[model samples]
Structure formats: C-alpha cells, structure tokens
Target chain A: MTVNIISISQITSYLRELLENDVMLSDIWVLGEVSNLKRASSGHYYFTLKDDAAALDVAMWRTYTSRLTHNLQNGDAVLAHGRVSIYEPSGRLQFYVDMLQPAGVGLLHARFEELKQRLAAEGLFDESRKRPLPPLPHRIGIATSAQAAALRDILTVLARRYPLVEVVLSPCLVQGERAPDSISAALYRLYAQDVDLIILARGGGSIEDLWCFNEEIVARTVFASPVPVITGVGHETDTTIVDYVADVRAATPSAAAEQAVPDMAVLAEAVTVLRQQLDEAMSAQLWMHQNALHSATATLQRQNPALWLARSRQQVDDLVQRATRQVRYLTERRQLQLDGLRQQLITLSPYATLHRGYAVVQRTSDGGVVTAPAQVQRGERLRLTLRAGELAAVAAPPAPIEEQHTDD
Target chain B: MTETSTETYETLYTRLQETVAQLEVGNLPLAEALALYEQGVQLAAACQRLLDSAELRVQQLQSDQPDDQ
Candidate 1:
C-alpha cells in the first residue's frame, strides 16, 4: 500500500484542525508565568505563557480582554482559560484567552503593597495634606520632553477646550538615566516661575521606561511641590510612586491635562446660570418696588391736600418700617456677635482662671508663673499668683511633711 | 445668593490665614469662634467650588483628548 504526498499547507491545515478540534484541547485551562506581555494600541494583548518545560503563544482580543480582572505583566503567574486553537496562517498553535487571574500574590503585588505601606506611614497619600489644584490657572506648566506624544496631546487638548490656560512647557526628560534629576529640576523651575499648576506626564511604556516616575527623587519632588502637581505616569494598568505622591493622579498624559485645568464650556454654563439667577432676582426686586410705589400713589389720590399731608406722613412712617426692620436686624446680629465675644472673653479672662481656683506661682526673675516645682530652689526668691492679685514670696522647700507621714 | 456664602478667593485665603493665626497663639472665644467658623465654612465652600470647578473643567477639557485622561 502507498500513501499520496500532500502540500505543506495541507499537512499543517490538517494538523491545525486536528489540534483545534481535539475535544480535550478545544476548551482548556493553562497555568503558567506570563512573559513579554504587550498590550497593543488596538487593545489586543499578545503574550507568551510559559512553564519550566515549554511556552505557548497566546492572544487575547479586546472583547474578552475586559473580562479579565488581573493586569497582565511580564513574569506574572496566571491561570488562563481559553480555547486552544492553531493559527492556520502561521501553523503555530496559540491560546485564545477568555480569563486570567493572578496566582496568589505576585512579586509586583507584594512590592506595591510594601511601597504603599511605607508611603502611607510617611504621610505621602494623606488627603488632608493633598493640596487642591488651582482652577482657571493663568499658566499651566508641563514637565515633559518637547518631543513626547504626551506633550502634544496635552497642548492639543488645552488649545481645544481651554484656550485661556496659558501653558508653559518646562520640557525635560521623562524617562531614561537623567530623567529623575531633570524632572525634579523642571518642577522647581516651574515653581519658581510661579505657574498656577504643574503637570508631570509621560506616555505609557515598559516598567523600565516608566522607572523615572518610580524613582525616589521624583516622588520627593512631587511631594514638596508648592504648586499643585499632577502625575500622569502611564497606562491605567500601571502604578508608580509619583502617582501616590501627586495631589492628583491621572491614568494617562491627557488625563493629567484634564486634571490640571477647568473646562471652559462648564464655566460658561455656570456663568450663564448665574446670570439667569441674577436677572430673575432683579426682576423680582423690581416688581416689589413697583407694587410699593403704586400703593403709595393710590393712598395720596384718595385724600385732599391736608388729608393727603397726613396720609403722606403716614406713608413716610410706613417707609420707616423697612429702615426699622433693617436696623433691628443689624442690631440683633451685632448684639449676637457682641454677646458671643463677651462670652468668649469671660472664658479666656484671668479672672476665669481664678474662678477655676488655679493659682499661678510667679518667680521673682519675672512676672511669669513658676509652673514646675523644680523651677524654684530653696533660698531662692519667688512670687505668687493669687486669686486677688500678684504677691511676692520667697521660694521655700516642702517642710518634712512627707517625712512626717513616713515616720507615722 | 448671600454674600456671606459666596466669598471670593481672596476672602477664602484671608479666612485661612485668620484660622491659622487663631490656631497659632491662643484659643478663640467659643461664640466668636462659632461665627468665625460659620464664615469659614462659607469661605471653604467657595474655595471648594473653585477646586471642584477646576477639576471638573479639566475633566471636560481632556475628555476628548487622545490620552486616557
């Protein structure tokens, strides 16, 4: 018996379908460490899932990618569930991932937590300490390289949404060896220029590419900035130290720009609303004045000259009602304030301390109280604070009272 | 709106400075402090409105940009 030869494509295609259709392999689960995890612009994730023995190529399309909870990173131990299929074109078998979870706590997770705890104890992320970014900043200074896409994106957004924001680009290295120093100096320079706000931004990249933001120098720089600082370090999936120290953190460069300034459209809408409210209030006031004037005229027409004179006096008295009300209202308010001040003064007065029966022992050196027993030495001169008035005295040691008690 | 509730930026800064000054040397009278605090609250609200407006505006400004901001 003889077998006919097939083309290369035919064999691979047959093998592809055979492996793809294998019931057990069709829907499978894989446990491996992720390597070379790259998220492309299209939202597809391409990576290698490897164990000690072998590695399998894997691709996660955007649709299924959203379902995955854990962020994928190189060397992350993960469990992937997907359909095992062969790429017919490349004749290479790859996994189409549908789910992924971290295997216990990964190294990155541990490091992230450790850094978080250290920074938290150092009060870096304190909300009370977080300065609010200025709105309608006259000039927004950016600390990023002139050539970066982040700068372009920021400039483009500012020009489009808020032309009023005078942007000052403090161009500096966002990454690489000199990035940390450059970033810190750039911040100082912007601060010196009295920029209303500062933005530290960079496009997403590898851990090393974003290492500049993760540096101690960068974190300290962000922490000490007098001008509110915003950090746009990397993609949403990535977190860095600078992000923690920043007054506000943006997942991306453009977000940093958004976080740094106020929207013009919203401001316009607010102004419009205020204007409408003012108009309504003014109209209501006008209506009230018109009704008052009409009432007064009717009263005048109803009376003869002498009668009208009396009536006019009555109207004038009536007008005083408003003035009287205003005076009473102001007086009541002032009385309330004055009463409060008096009460406060009573509480703070030295006489109040006398009422509390707390006496101050003053030293002869000065009129100040001798608070500590050690402050006075035997045979030394001292003064006393009495409920009535200040009294001069000589410092004396306790007369053997403790010794007498001990003897008894 | 009441002027008390709509303090400007300078007034807010003045209130902050006053609070710091009051906090520094000695205690303020409780009643006087209550009034000051109420005024401080108005100042705080005004300041917060500014901050919130700034944040919201930034969000709006960058909402359509080519980055994840």
Candidate 2:
C-alpha cells in the first residue's frame, strides 16, 4: 500500500495561520517556571517557561518589556497568557506574550522586582517623601471588608488597646476582581473624613487573591493619602504592594493596632517615673536654696556688725582711760620741772643775797660803786650799797681807810 | 467617683506644690504646719491613684495584643 506525504512548509504555514487567527489561542494561559531567558538588543525579552517536566519558549516584545516591573531569570514560576507560533527561521515553537502575570510570587516576583526597580529609580519610595505616623491617632478609619478576619482582628485589637479610640469603618472588597476599586474608594472616603489614621487591612491569601492590592490604582491611592495609612494586609511572611506604599506596614492587624496607641501601663509607668524625677529634682533644688540661706545666716551671725561695733566701742573706752592717765602723768612731770625753775629764780633774787649778809658800796652821785679811789671823787660822791637797799655816805677818799686804822 | 477621684489627684498635686513651698517659708504657726502636713499625705495618696491609672495604660501599649498574647 502506497502512503501520501504532505510538504513540511505547508504544514507549518497552516498551523501558524490557525494559531494567529484563533481567539482562544490568542488568549491562552500557561503555568510554568521560566528558564533560558534571552533579551535582544531591541529591548525584547525571550525566555523559556518551564516546570519540572515540560517547557515552552516565551517572548515579550519591547513595549511589554518596557512595561515590565521585575527582572526575569531562569527557573521562575509564572502564568503567561499569549498566542503560540513557530519561529519561521528556527522552526521552534514559541509563545509570543502580550500580557504577562506572575504565577506565584516567584514569577510575578521578578516582574514585581523589575517594576519596583523602575519605580524606585523614579524615587517613588524615596525616604524624603515618606511620612511619619501620628503619635496618637484619634479617629481611626478602617478600610477592609466587613466580613474579613483582618477587620475583626483590627477592631478587636483597637477596642482592647484603646477602648476610647473612635473607629470609623468603611467597608470594601479586600480581594478578587473588584478589590482594587473598592479599596481605592474606601481610602477616598476615609480621607474625606477627619481621621487621624486609616488602616488598610486584609487576611492572608495567595498571590492572585491579593493582586488587587498590587494594582496601580491601589498603590497610587495609598501613596496619595492625606491621612497616614497603615497596611496590615496579611500574615507576617506575606508582603503586598500596598505594604510598600503605606505609611506603616504592620505584621498583622492586631500589631497595627498596637502601633497606633501607646500602652497604658507603660505610659503610666513613664508618667510616674517622670513625676518621681521631678520630685527629686525639685526637692534637691529647694534643699540647695535652703542651704544657701542657712550659710548666709551663719555668716551673718558670726560676723554681725553690731557685735563688732560693741567690741570697737569697748576698745575706744579703754583708749580714752589710757589717754587720760598719760595726760595726768605728763602734767605732773611738767609741774615738777616748773617748781625747780622757781627755786632757781629764788636763788638768783637780791633778797636772797641780803639774807646771805652781803653788802655793796656805791658813790652817792648817781649811786656809783667805789671800786677805786679815782672813782671816789672825795666827798663829792659817796654812797653805801647794801643787799637790801642803798644809803647815802661821804667817801673821804683813800685817807678814810688810814684814819680808821688810827681810831682803832 | 472615678472622675472625681482623678480630679482630686490633680488638685492634690497642685496644692502640694503650693503648700510645700509655703511650709518651707516657715512663717506658718506650729498648728497650721501640722495640719498642712496631714493634707500633704492625702494629696500623696491621690497622686498614687493617678499613677495607678496611668500604669494600666502603659501595660496595654507595651504588651502583646490579647489575641496574639
């Protein structure tokens, strides 16, 4: 029996036409890990999507490459939706990608990384632009589904942590197709009110389930929030785009609540400690002032001017007595010297000579003394001088002495 | 009662500051001084109550949220 053979080109052409025209194939979804990635100079990316057993060649054009946010590497798990075609030259089967979504965090993580890098380069996550959380939030607006465990956890924690904290709930779909829009709207509503803080919370889910939070709308909304927003989107291990953009990222809803309010016990202790310190400081300062006053009093007591004045007055009185004694001694010595001078004057007096029985002779004329005969001019001048007084007499010259010898 | 008690604690603190200064001035009579000292004890009790209230608040912030705890 003879068998008919078809041309290889014809078969390849027909398959290509079918794949290109078929809408279902045009929107095919394949799940695998990426291997053997090749990027061209034209900024297009070529790589193989694979798992443990099978692999498929994938291509993302320059436009899609530019839009990609994460890095692609070997062994990346991803769910790619695109049309299948044969490269005419290499004749290899390849999936030309239009829209690429990561399968798990592994594949999408690469895209996520790429997007993060690009956005980071644009400074979307700059530290300078990041805002600080309020010290104590008053009106807390919660953005999550009413049925979500995240909401319950947050509410319970808030109620217990700070019972008086006013909670304003704005319900929204946390996951699924409508989650992004719902979250965005919820944030808008919360912002419109005067809330101190807004918590965007959701329970843990798979990458796809939490994809809405990673949407551009949600990220922008979180970034543009006027009131500080805290994201408690999942468990501690899970990270979402919302977490990156939020003002604060908490490990869980309860933890977020814990962050929002100060612990009552710790605050109380701090207040008490401060009060004690204030007391000690004030007491120490007061004591210091009192001691200063005491020192001043002691100094004044020891050196009282009035006491010194009393002592000085005593010294003045003693000096006055000593001065009076010195004056009396000096006056007595002066009187003794005056009495000796009076005795000398008395010895020099003529009456004192008369008492010694001394007589003086003088001529009667002008009471001249007859010391020589020439001075006694005969009887013309003669006088006798006595210590007591003077008397008139005739001198007889030198013959008077001789005549007196004859009479004897 | 709680609210009034809290108010008393604040009033006591304020009065203690003033009265302690006045006593230190030493112009008051012996009787007046003894009376103020007794009042000081009451004010100290009020301050302790306020401190106790604050301790509860501090404990809440420092410890794990009850669910996690």
Candidate 3:
C-alpha cells in the first residue's frame, strides 16, 4: 500500500468525483417522507427525506424549485429524482433533486415515459398510421365503464349530433388492476360486432385511475381495431398511450362521440343545397333546349312556302302590268301604219288619172276605139266618152283611099 | 317500429351528388335530363326522410356474455 498526503479540499474533491461518476447514484429516484422542509431566500429548497430505516439530505436548485407542483411539508411521502453526489465543502453525501412528485405518481410517470419512448420507437404512434374517421358512421361502438359519467356524456352527444347512428356500448372496468385487460376485451367485443367506428373513453381521474388507458395492452388493441377510433380518456390535460394510437383524439368523452358521426342538420342542409343545384341545372338545360327550338322555328319560318308563294305572286303581277303596257304600244303603232297606207292608196288610184284625160271615141258594135274615118262602115254606129259622160253617133263612109290619107 | 329501408342515407346522398354532377355537365338530352332530375328529387327526399325519422338507439353488452354470433 502507498500512503499519500492530501488536504481537506483534495479529499472532498476526490469523494465528489467518485460519487458523481457512479452510474446508479448519479441519476436516481428515491421515495421517502419529507422532513425538515425549508425554503431559503435564494429560492432554493432544503429538506430531509426519511424513512423508517434512515434519512437523506436533499437540495433543489432555484431553477428546479419553480417546477415543483406541490408545496413541500413535513411528513409528506414523496419521490425525489436527482443525482447523489458528495458536497465538496462538507464532504457529505447529498441528493441534488431536480424533480419531486407524489411517490406512486412519480413512479408511474417514469414507467409512462419509458413505455411511451419504447412504443414511439416501434412506430406505434406514427401519424401515417392514424386512420381517418368516417364522415358518416352508421354504427359507433363505445368502450367505457357502464357506470361512468363518460358514457352518459358520450351518449348525450351522439344523440344530439347524429341520431342516425346505432350506438353499442361494450362496458368494462376503467380503473384498478384489471382495467387494462377489461378495456382490451371491450375493444374486441365491439370489433366482433363490426362497428364502423369506436370511441374509447373514460372520465377524469387520478393518474392511477387512468393508468389502464396508458397500458400496453389497451394501446395495442386500439391500434389493431378494424375501424377508426376516437379516444377521450381522462381530462384534456391527461394524455395516454391509447390517445396516441387512436385515429382521433378528443378533449372529452362528448367530443369523441361528436367526432364519431356527422350532424344531421348539416347533412340535411347539404341535401337541400344539392337539390337546389339540381333544380338550377335542369332549368338551365331546359332553357338551352327552348332557345335552340326557338331559333329552329325562326329558321323554318324563313323557308316557309307561303312566303315563297307571296314573292312569286308579286313577280307575276309585275309581269302582267308590263305585258299590258307592251300590247297597248303595239296596237297604237299598227293603227298609225294602217292610216298612212290608206292615204298612199288614195294617191295611186286610177280614177284620178281618168279625171285629167280628154274625150275618146269607140265603135259601139265592138266596143273599139276609132281613130280614123275609115274605121266605121257606111252605116256603123260610134260612141264618144269623156271623163264623166258618154255619147253615141252614126257615121257614113264613102271616102277614097287618097282623100283619106290627105285628111290624116 | 322504425321505418327501415335497404338504402342508407350515405348511398342516397352519394346518388344525389352524382345526379347533380351529371346535370351540371349540361350535355344530356332533354328527356334524359328530366328523368335524372326526377330521380335526384326522389333521392333527396329519401335522404331527408331518413334524417327526419332517425332516433339514437343505445345498447350495452353483458361483460361476461359469451360470443353468441
């Protein structure tokens, strides 16, 4: 063995290092009754945690003291969490507490944190795995204590929001040691009935009372449910593993029921809106057809035979008027030509030539004109003609040829 | 006794929605559109009837009862 000389500071420092480095002592929780509790002007807390066997000195820094949920008093059982270390100045073991809670609750909270981390690592609480609740659930299965006020609240909400849904309650123990198994069994029972949705609910209670909702068995059952689940366990502040695994988390049991189904009034209003849309759509379609028919009728009127006949009649009347005017002009031209021809005929008449001539002689017996004295016999008859009269005469002839020639 | 029908409110509502959508397209013939309008009116009435006549029914299972399915 080697002997070494050291001062008090050195020994205290060594002891502090040894105690601080010890894994089990560095971070731990100890349950004991609080004794000699004191608050200093620095906002630090000094107390002694004692049991039947022994006592330990505890100190909480000002930063941690503000986090204390409960005021410390003498003889109150508490679970204090901190590191055990040797105080260098006094070379004494002291618990430097950072957290203090009621004994059982503190222990339960530790287990809860551990389980939450383990389950979260397994992806049990993944948001992607969360199922969407049905917009209109036909049947909603409720898993809760039959005698619990949560059940009444859920029922009242369901009745008010959506009376169309059929509610099936699978009653179970919501507290105590057997509650975890009871809750899981209730979930299976609801599943067997083929519920469209499920509501897991419990009224507000102590952490111990609500411990079953935090149980692994209940969480697994909720995660495995065929339908989507809505969880409303404990109060708004009390969250559990089931809430993490459920599809929807509500603040209270009534809220869970509300989440399970849609309101009838809203559905009715939607139906009315849809009906109105249908009416408007149908009216628009009809109007379009009516307009099309109107245009078609107008087009048909333009092509009507009656209108074509009227146009043709007008054309015929115009032609008749032109034909009458042309006939009148031709008649007038023909009359004028006839009158001029008659006047020319009058100028060329033979009677006019006779009017200008002298008298002429003719033999009456033969109706021959005589020009010489020998043309008639000794007792021949002769006739004289003028322009307007005729005369008859007798002639004697006994002249010699020489004498007749001399007369010519 | 409750008047129970084979058609659910969801089914009727879905049909009503489809009918409205088809009508909104505005391409169907007059007779066809008229028939669809009549069908949509009936579907809407059926939905409203279901909603109006609804009553919440609550039942509890015996904890110790065996599965009787």
Q: Deviation in angstroms for A396 in model 1?
A: 99
lDDT of 3 by residue, A1-408 (tens): 999888999888888888889999988889999989899999999989999999899999999999988877888888888999877777778999999888878889877877898999998899998888888787789999888799999989888888888888898888888888888998898999867999999999988889999999998998899989899998999999889989899988988887788988899999999999999999999999999999999999999999999999999999999999999999999999999998788768754555788567789999887888878886788887777888878877667889999999
- Clashing pairs for model 1 are A255-B69, A262-B57, A263-B57
How many clashes does each candidate structure show, in the order listed? 3, 24, 0
User: What residue pairs clash in candidate 3, if any at all?
Assistant: none
Q: Write the per-residue lDDT of candidate 2 for residues A1-408, one digit (tens) a residue.
A: 888888888788877887788888776767887778888999998998887787778888999878766776677667676788887666678899876655664456555665666666766566677677765555678887776688778777766655545577777777778778877887787787777888888888887787787777888898888988888877898887778788788988878888876554564454455445445544555566678789999999989989999999999999999999999999999999999999999999866876788666765657665567787666675556576676777666466877889999
TM-score of each model, in listed order: 0.43, 0.50, 0.71
Better of 1 and 2 by DockQ: 2
Instruction: Specify the poorest-scoring 10-residue window by lDDT in model 2 chain A.
Output: A273-282
Write the residue-wise lDDT of candidate 2 on B27-62 in tens digits.
455466556656655565565665454321111111
How far off is model 2, as Cα RMSD? 13.5
Ranking by TM-score: 3, 2, 1
True contacts kept of 2: 0.01
The 10-residue segment with the lowest total lDDT in model 1 chain A: A274-283
True contacts kept of each: 0.00, 0.01, 0.76
Per-residue lDDT of B9-68 in model 3, one digit per residue for the tens?
778899999999999999789999999999999999999988898789887777863331
